[model samples]
Target: MSRMSTPAESLTRPDGSPIRVLVVDDEQTLADLLASALRYEGWEVTTAGTGRAAVRLAQELTPDVIVLDIMLPDFDGMEVMHRIHGHQPNVPVLFLTAKDAVEDRVAGLTAGGDDYVTKPFSLEEVVARLRALLRRSGASAEKPANVLEVGDLRMDEDSHEVWRGEDEIHLTATEFELLRYLMRNPRRVLSKPQILDRVWNYDFGGQANIVELYISYLRRKIDKGREPMIHTMRGVGYVLKPAVAQ
Candidate 1:
């Protein structure tokens, strides 16, 4: 007898709606199976068996995340991704491919895929990747407070305004949320896994370098010409605290 997989507990939106996901694959059985697993995670799942259908459904469904197969029946997966992006530019995409070559992965990422998984992958890994993508893109269900402050940096969640000392700093929504997470836990050493879980809301199975990338972005905007408050604990994690006197 086949083992039955249990659905993992997941977070829901403020309105209690499940996160939306679009699964695209030329193989009908694969698409349905993937959709079933996603639905098991308590997400709203839509499936498309062709690239053109995927693009059309993406527009109509406006899913929070998309799982796209690199190979398609009617059109190239990349072209489908482009078409869908034309309508919903910020929707996160995870490419599914049978090709495991570096070039294929690089091509998919270069074409604006947020992440990807090679074929013959476990369903649990796919779900985790989707969760991380949603978290990084601010598509997660949990919403923070209206304002957050740490040191001289202030972020007004309502107006989406950020200020460092006397100057106002502009940040993208993702950056703002990352900063808020850091500010919320001042002086605490947060490892990459911890940051991924708390800030991105996923247990990432890939590289942790994304954390470093966002940290550098925050430093340039928040620490430039000021006492640096974001500190790296070397092989541990990161800490945010007040800078000391010179």
Candidate 2:
């Protein structure tokens, strides 16, 4: 199953600019993953692998929020937060800690960290936490709605409900996830590997067939008796777009 999902609402700064985010983690892969996830929400993201770099970037960007790893090469996240607070006092900080680091969690919160997520956490969880922090800090202007639509098809992410025009549609958990990913990037061709990574959370070896199988499943339910909104691009990939009126 996928660990990430589209946010219900896209948030921006009060000036309608992308919400600036600073992601600080010594683990390059994790940092890049987090940065990608945040950017998908239409936020501007910058990453730093050291506490010193984090402090410097925070000063340069004045990010609306920070995702700081508790462990860093130069210094701990606490010191980075302290250094940054010296300048941008109100910027929200979300700490990343080890799963078993109870002391670190306590210490981080006590040291004025806005929130914390343990390692092995989902991208969705981190995004949700950051959104909450942004709202609490008055740093976000949210465009409201949990529903995603393309053509006459609509999905309510919060309610787990889907509809084709006035008719409701039912889907299995995997099918729902696959459709959600397609809906999220309407009209963009999604390669089999991209679909697998986003919906299944990992590569299925070279078995890109799983993506094809699920795409077929979604097509049967979503386009069986209606104008087809899901299309295949030969060897390229799949795309979802508004159905042309007959």
Report the Cα RMSD per candidate: 5.0, 14.8
Residue-wise C-alpha lDDT for candidate 2, range 117-221, written one tens digit per residue: 888888988898888677645578742347898999999875557899898987654566688889999989999989877765555355687677678878888
TM-score of every candidate relative to the true structure: 0.65, 0.57
The C-alpha local distance difference test score for the whole of candidate 1 amounts to 0.78
Instruction: Give the top-scoring candidate (TM-score).
Output: 1
Candidate 2 lowest-lDDT run of ten: 136-145
| C-alpha local distance difference test of each model | 0.78, 0.81
Q: List, residue by residue over 40-98, the lDDT tens digit for candidate 1.
A: 78889999889878888987888888999999888988999899988887788889999
Mark the regions of model 2 whose C-alpha exceeds 4 Å error after superposition.
1-3, 143-246
